[model samples]
Target: MPDIIQLLPEYLANQIAAGEVVQRPASVVKELLENAVDAGATSVQLIVKEAGKQLVQVVDNGSGMSATDARMSLERHATSKIRSTEDLFRIRTLGFRGEALASIAAVAQVEIRTKQPGQDTGTLLLVEGSQVTSQTPTACPDGTSIAVKNLFFNVPARRNFLKSNAVEMRHILDEFQHLALANPHIAFSLYQNDLEVFNLPAAKLSQRIVALLGNTYKEQLAGCEEVTPFITVKGYIGKPESSKKSRGDQFFFVNNRFIRSAYLNHAVLSAYEGLLARDTHPFYVLFLELDPKAIDINVHPTKTEIKFEDEKTVYAVVRAAVRQALGLHSLTPSLDFEGDVNFAPIRPLRTSTGGNSFGSGGAALPAPARAVEFNPDALAASVAAAARGLSAAPKSARCPRGPPSRPAASWRPFIASWASPCARPKPKCRPSRQLPRCLSCLLHTRSRPKTRARSRWPPRPWQRPQPARHAGAGPLRAAGREVGPDAHRPGGRP
Candidate 1:
């Protein structure tokens, strides 16, 4: 190539750089949110449309820049965080990469309005595709409100690469959750399609978690804290049982800045190896604190990837801290060694198939049966119609009665025998096996032949009573037990 590196057009250079800094909508959210934090924002708001394809706005009450600084922020390699080569190794801020703003502005239409606290007026900058269209004086709040619109508008290829709105929204939520969790003291709000998803006031990490996730997490959290001469780790890791099938809940932040480190993530998962099911993922919001010099945040354009000097030590410490916290949490389930251990009796649904799907505790489930070609809903309607026709007939055509009802005590013996020593209630008398005989007597005598119990009992597996299988076909079979009443004992804990 002729003079391949001699000179690259400014717009093309920015677009090329954007590839590393803005991979998706989540990337934009991460960059903007980090900028807000770097600005010393105590409160931040994120609003998005079509998951930032159409718009992404981050409003922050931080130290807003002057008109000159605001314009310079959109230029490549223009940053306030660092000025010299040595500053690269001693990075402390969330955004040291001067590429985020330029990369974002290169692919989208960006509008920045800023005003310092004491400034009487603010500056409004309108930029599109790395070119500033206007920069004028305006009246605005004492903070910054940056809006990015029409993302990848000039880059059709990049625009085509975006995922669906729902998928992108989930990614945005993930970034918001990470930042919000790391800086729990900051008030954060999020809106999507004009509906408020989160409105968290400045609060403790635990409270912030509940606010971000939902109230259901209130009981599932366990606190973790560890400190050494070189590093300190603190935050909450969800209980082993509370893990999900997906990886949404895990979070790692170094010195209050969100980061992505598969090495550290593995450390967390390793700590939970035995406690969690193989397919489930534990939730954690851990914050690691250490000197800036020990970690390099400039390796990645987005600054989410960092390299630690003594990675192995950090990994071990993180793992131990998480494991120790879980151990101290009484919520950790314990095996009842005092009682008999029955392995084949029941396979408690250890991992759900959706959302929260991660862990090392999954009992290999039998593969599902292939579905046969049939429509059962139509069959059900036909059966119900036949029953109605029969019921409308004369008394002489009525079907014969079936069985009689049994007294409650008749079933006591089976319940008493199966009851575990760990059962919650106070001491109670155990019934005898003769209870089934009592039921037999009641069924033979007291129960009416024609009338059936009007109970809301769920249909039995065999009684699911499917359409008659073809006479020449094999016996209809299922791969797994369609759990009957006996499968899940009443009031039993999983």
Candidate 2:
């Protein structure tokens, strides 16, 4: 026998790991956008062609890496994020696992052009399937620009597993929106197929929300905030009226990292128990800030799922904040005081006939209608008079009827007897299946113990110890005696 254990090559290992981190084009979008945020980029630009199948470029004005760092970034498990296992419990950055760039490089053709402030010249590095094709000095800006082309080119099967362009684009849009919403202070832009989709400048969270979601949100947002020694919850939740059946509008960010948690979602929903329609979900962009040691984000490969040290505390804080916001919205009146017509300053009428149809004859429009006082007493009197007249009408005139077939006196007695519960006359009496005491003593001295078990003897109704159907098959016929039709009474009475 020969020893058959062998190690997987670095490139092969990276590709296998890529399957977990890069499931689709959207996965690449998420990883890259998060990396840009982690790099402390204030302005980021994203360009996609063919829904990220052919090209996905990300340019950022952040602290860029040097020549050695650029080359080492493509190697497996190479990172500047963590040094030991203790760092895993206190991770605050978005892309700290060190697998994003390596796994991405393993499956795609990637280009890197980066320059730091201190370096006079920039570095341009090209990689194909985890192999460096070239590395040289280039004239680029004082930041980083990474362009990924032909994603999954080496792994044809992975490319085949991708969805349609529209679906992939929607996923990419979702990731971009999440990042933009998470960091409103950072400017972000996206272009797809040479068409501008979004160009958001640095603004407050409310402005960022309007820029991405639309103007309708301007009126629907309600502020939610709660601060404690353990955690701090703050965000904007949509008013109950703006909630919908679709779930695309809900978001949750922990430490500025987007996450998905059904437990916490239920907490927010519980606060809106009676306010929401069935199957409808409210729109929210809640962010939770806590000490890094309170959460473990390394449980999953993508780092979207996390384990909290005390989940109940988080749930209580989220629920309380949402409920308080809803209460505040209720207290705020719906009317805009400034736009009320009643309080508007009256203007002088212009009696001109230029293009106004109302002033065609050069006469000012008629004065506005005057207010009229209503009399509730008069209205009530008229309603009562109408009710009195209706009641005075004869019943025959109100409901038409045909002549009766029989006299009322005849049917009255018949109905009374038929409707009576005792109308069905009972039998005078009938002999039961049980024998008399003298007969049983002569037949057998041993008594048969009474039992109401279903297997032995089924329980009887008020007078159902022996059904009428069993009358002809009774033991009286076997004893050669004609038992009179006198039955046992319900309570054993004569």
Index of the highest-TM-score prediction: 2
Every candidate's lDDT = 0.78, 0.79
What residue runs in model 1 are displaced by over 4 Å at the alpha carbon? 1-5, 331-494
lDDT of 1 by residue, 309-393 (tens): 9999999999999988988886456776799766786666543344433366644544455988788997765433333332222
The candidate scoring highest on lDDT is 2
Off by over 4 Å in 2: 331-494
Quality of model 2 by C-alpha lDDT = 0.79
lDDT of 2 by residue, 408-455 (tens): 333344333321211112332122354222211222234334655343
